[model samples]
Target: EDQVTQSPEALRLQEGESSSLNCSYTVSGLRGLFWYRQDPGKGPEFLFTLYSAGEEKEKERLKATLTKKESFLHITAPKPEDSATYLCAVQERKTSYDKVIFGPGTSLSVIP
Candidate 1:
């Protein structure tokens, strides 16, 4: 079975502050890792997809990077609008199909 863990369960940051969120995983075979952001009462919004180690993607103030054992989502000069729960999902390679495993998620609060 594939498993993922997100660190700091929750984070509090002042507006314009920057930080990095962690997502670590363990699986038999990894297909890819996905990043998402969810606001209260809304479904997770797709952020980035990483296929292999050393891969990176960015959107506005958010940047996601992947490694062999874990992935990181870095927030640069974030604003209150960026405050949301960040999630990391991993797709495990299966014989017939792919199984996705999602991390618990890290809730972020940015105060102005």
Candidate 2:
């Protein structure tokens, strides 16, 4: 079975504070690792796509890295607007490419 789990269901941070959340996974033949940011009542906005281990991507206050077994999303100097649900997904080698699975996500709040 394919699965992805994230730690610290919710994280509270002050403005300019930095931290990282973890995404653990167990999947058969990973094709891609995806990171997304979602706000309330909206679909996730794709951030990064890690295709292999030791790969990394970044944008503004967010950085995503991938490993053989898991992925990490690091938030640096987060602002209040950066607060949202950080979602991690994995695309496995399935019969259909649309069968991507997502983690529950880490809800983050940045206090100004």
Best by TM-score: 1
Each prediction's TM-score versus the true structure: 0.97, 0.94
Tens digit of lDDT per residue, candidate 2, span 17-103?
A: 999999999998898999999999999999999999999999988899999999999999999999999999988886755468999
lDDT of candidate 1 vs native? 0.96
Error of 1 at 6 (Å): 0.2
**For every model in order, what is the number of clashing pairs?**
0, 0
Give all candidates' CA lDDT scores.
0.96, 0.92
Off by over 4 Å in 2: 95-98
Scored by Cα lDDT, where does model 2 land?
0.92
